[model samples]
Structures are given as C-alpha cells and as structure tokens.
Target: MLKTTLGQWRMFRAVVEHGGFSQAGDAIHKSQSTIHHAVQKLEDSLGIKLLQVKGRKVGLTQAGELMLRRANYLLDEAAKLEAVATGLGAGTETQLKIAVDEVFPQNLLYRVLDTVSAQFPLLRIELMETVLSGAQELLEKARVDIALSPVPLANGFNEEFCQIEFLAVASPQHALHQQTQALSYEDLKSHRQIVVRDSASNSGKDVGWLGADQRWTVSHVRTSIDMISQGFGYAWLPVPAIEQELQSGLLKPLPLTQGVKRTAQLYLCFADGDRLGPAARTFIGEVRYQSESLLTAEQLSDSN
Candidate 1:
C-alpha cells in the first residue's frame, strides 16, 4: 500500500481542474514552481506519471484520472468525518448547507424551510443563492450539502432532484394584455423584453416564438422579474416565483401558440452519496415532499 499525503491529493485535484500547474497555482494561491514540485513529488511517490506535458498544455494520464476520482472520494469522506465530529460536540441537529439557483422563488423555498424548521428547529440551515453553474460547482466541491438548480445539470453532475415548470410572463399593464387571449411569439419579440442571459453561453435562444434581443440581458431571475414589474421589459419567469403576481393580476401569462413551457428540474447533488448526515437527509426529504405537494396542487388546479 502506498502512503499518500493530503497535500499531494489536493495538488493532483487542482492540476486536474486547472489543466496546468500554473493555472492550478493561481487557483490555490501558490507559486507555479511549488505546485509543480508537489505534483512531481506525488508522481515520484506513487511511482507513476500522472500528467503528460504536451507542449504548453497538460493532459491527465489514465492513472491520473483514476487517481483524481479516488482523491475526490477520499476528500469528501474526510470532510464528512469532520462535519460529523463537529456536529456531535455541537448538538443532535447538524448544519445543512444548500446552494440554490438565483431564479428559485424565495417564497417557495421559505415555505419548504418553514416546514423543516417546524419539524427540526434545532438544525441550522444555510442557503446560498447563486448562478446555476456556480451552484453545481459548490455541490461538487462539497461546499454545499445540496443544491436546488435547473433540471439538467449544466456540468457533469448527476441529477438526483425533481423538476418544476417555467412560465413566460409579463406585467398586467403591459401592451401584451391587449392580445392576452391570443399571444404569439411575434408579439412578444416586438415588445421590449428582459431576459435571463445564458451565463454559460453568449448566444440567446429564441424561447418559443419570442426572439431575445441582446439589449436587455438580466443576469438574475429576481432582477428580471423586478424589471418586468417596473415595465422595463417582459420576461419568462419561473411559475412558482411569479405565481402570486399572476394570480393577483399583477403579472399576466403570455398566450403563445406553442405555449412556451420549460421544465426546471431541482437536483440535490452531494459530494459523497453515502455520507449524508441526519440534517442533510432531513432537509432533502422536506424539499422532496414540498415539491411533490406543490406539483400535486398545480395538477389538481389544472384539472379543476
């Protein structure tokens, strides 16, 4: 059995992420020479060349890739152990850290959290609202216990969550209301629009029949809704976020020929699958229950 140091494992993981010692050094805030020396030491100790230096670029060898995966698993287990130990001394309830997409309606999440608080008031819940990609990264890094993000994982994260529907909406006083009974994509494109800029890509998709103009690129869903409410531009918001606004006639659903519908799946990704603590498991269960209940209510209303 080869003895591996945590520092070597961290260096290996960093190199795999940044693709080079220089970049990895920048990320880890270390000198490039130091990072290279550490990696060299690791390779020497393991008796294998982990990375192949191809010109200026660095590529992982088969052994390197395998080692990286194992390294991540080992690190995750170590973190869970620390968390468990800390939790034992603190109390029976553990802290649950969750990362959520900025587009998720706070009201809905609060409803879910309220239920969890009532059930387990002693548990500490930490919520972070960030971009979808950032949230996914947090989950992979074990920076968060779980994440609430769009259905499809933008990165290589495995989807272990539920899905919700997205709706395109506008303020009731907007010009689209004139044709509310028969809204088309063309009508929406002709009006000033506020859209969630695809942070992952510069190109915008023609949602349904509505063409996105590059002039108004709102980064956050909450900002998009605020802009639409102020009549700055119309936007496609998640139904749950703007459900109350639509019901109260503050915002109106666009009448599209194809009915612009997109499903936003909420995934609860974790770094270590087997190491979920009691608080993390309880929080996940609450979210799942809330999502199922909400879906059921929506279906019942639609049926009625």
Candidate 2:
C-alpha cells in the first residue's frame, strides 16, 4: 500500500504551483487550512520536509524540489489512468476528425481509412483535406483530433509519417522543353508557374521555387495539374498524384541542372494524445504500420 494518497500529492502540487497555500486554496476552491493540512500530511507520509517558510511565501526545500519532479510524473500518470477509464467507459468514439495534407499519397490514405472503417463501421470520419500549414493550423485550434502534415505543430508531439516525392515537370508542348541542353532557373524564370494556394488563412507561405515572372495560384492540386497538362504553366507536382499523366507522356519531367526532384517529409500529430480513445489509437497504429510497409517496399525497389 502507498503511504501517500493522490489527493495529498495534488494539493502539494497546487500549493507549489500557486506559490502559497492561500493562493492554491483559492485556485482549487478549498480553504487554506484544508490545503495546509494536505501538504502537512504529505510531508508526514514521506517523512521529510517538503516546504520551507521564507517571509510570507512558502518555498520548496532541496528535498521538496526533487520530490516535486517525481510527484509531477505520478500525477500525470494518474490523470492518464483516469482518462483511459473514461475512454473505456465511453466505448468507441462515434466520429473522428482527421486533417490530412493533400501532399500525402491518396492510395495509402485510402488503404488506412478502408481498414479503419472495416473495424468501426458505425464510426463517421470527418476528413479535412488541407495544404502545407493548414493541417497544423486545424490541430492547433483543436478542430481536428489528428493531423498529417509536412508542417509540425509547435512544441507538440509528432512522428515522421511519410515522405512525398515532388517532381518538377511541364507539358511536352511547354516552352521550357524547347531548350536543347539542361534547363536552369534563369531559363524557366521567363515562363509562367502554376502553384497551389496554401489552405491556411494565416501563417501560410509558399514552398519551393517561385521565380517565374508570371504566377498562377490555384486552390486544389487537381486544378494545378489540369493547368500544367494543358500547357497553361509548369509546376513541381507530387509524383503520386500525377503518375498517370507522367506515364502517358502528358507531363514530362524538367531537365533541370539540379533539384529536379524534392521530398517533403510529413509528420503525424495529435491534438491531445492522452485523451485519444481506442479508435483513434488504433487508427494511428495502422497508419504508422502502412507507411513503414510502403517505405520498406520503396527502399527495396531503390536498392535493386
């Protein structure tokens, strides 16, 4: 049996965080005497002095500082335990909100979703297709439970999800193809460029080359692809998205001196990791597993 109770540790933490017993009492809606008793009881249970009085405010002793760290870990674990219990009691979630950047492979996304839907037939998914920083923005606002984005959430948990291959390409009829030798940035600068607009309202910025004299910004990836294929303009497009066009000779890769291909690394982020229910956890695991499988297959093909 543990000598200290969770209540005691919680009160001790509140007192330390708020800087005094009265402040902690006010924060927690408890009387100062009640907070003081809990802290005193905690010190007694631990058989050590946790706080020392200095002037009007209380300060932690050397032992208190060390124990506080351990106490915080314990408290965090306890909270996670309660969250898990709550999730279990609530059963599987009826709906899940996911924000996926358009750059991620559609086939892989479909495969993961198909598997998840099979497992939870009754669950609804709100899939928000975003671009660049859009996914991260939705996660920051707590509008999505999970986000797959190249841009990671600031000071938040993230894992390398997948890599998207971007190839700079243009139509065979485009003016850039008229060059006899390898193309340079200077050669392409005179032509028009088609770019997809960033979906985020704020904190959105352009990526890759932007030196073309005339620029056309579109809202969707398909729009950019359509414009580029019809000889409207040239742009760096994702290989997975334009595979059919590339294979059929509708779009040709640019013979650039350098940077003909670029890889964008996408990350998996959660709005509140600890609060994720069973369905969300399972989906996260499946996505990771599928991405790993794809990466391994690609690596083997590259080696051969």
- lDDT (0 to 1) per candidate: 0.72, 0.91
What is the lDDT for 35 in model 2? Answer: 91
Best candidate, TM-score-wise?
Answer: 2
Q: Residue 237 of model 1: what lDDT?
A: 76
lDDT of 1 by residue, 1-304 (tens): 7667888788878988888988999999989998888889988888998999878889889898898888888986777788767766665555678888776657668887887777777778898776656676676556777777653444444555566577777777777777637776666667887756543332343333346443486677778878887767676677777777777777776777776677765666665544566666777777777767777887899999
User: Residue-wise lDDT of candidate 2 within 20-124, one digit each (tens)?
Assistant: 999999999999999999999888988999999889889999999999999988987787688668877888888888999998889999998989999999989
> Candidate 2: where are CA atoms >4 Å away?
1-86
Model 1: residue 145 alpha-carbon error in angstroms: 0.7
Q: Which residue pairs show collisions in model 2?
A: none
Clashes of each: 1, 0
- Tell me how candidate 2 scores on lDDT: 0.91
- Residue 54 of model 2 has an lDDT of 88
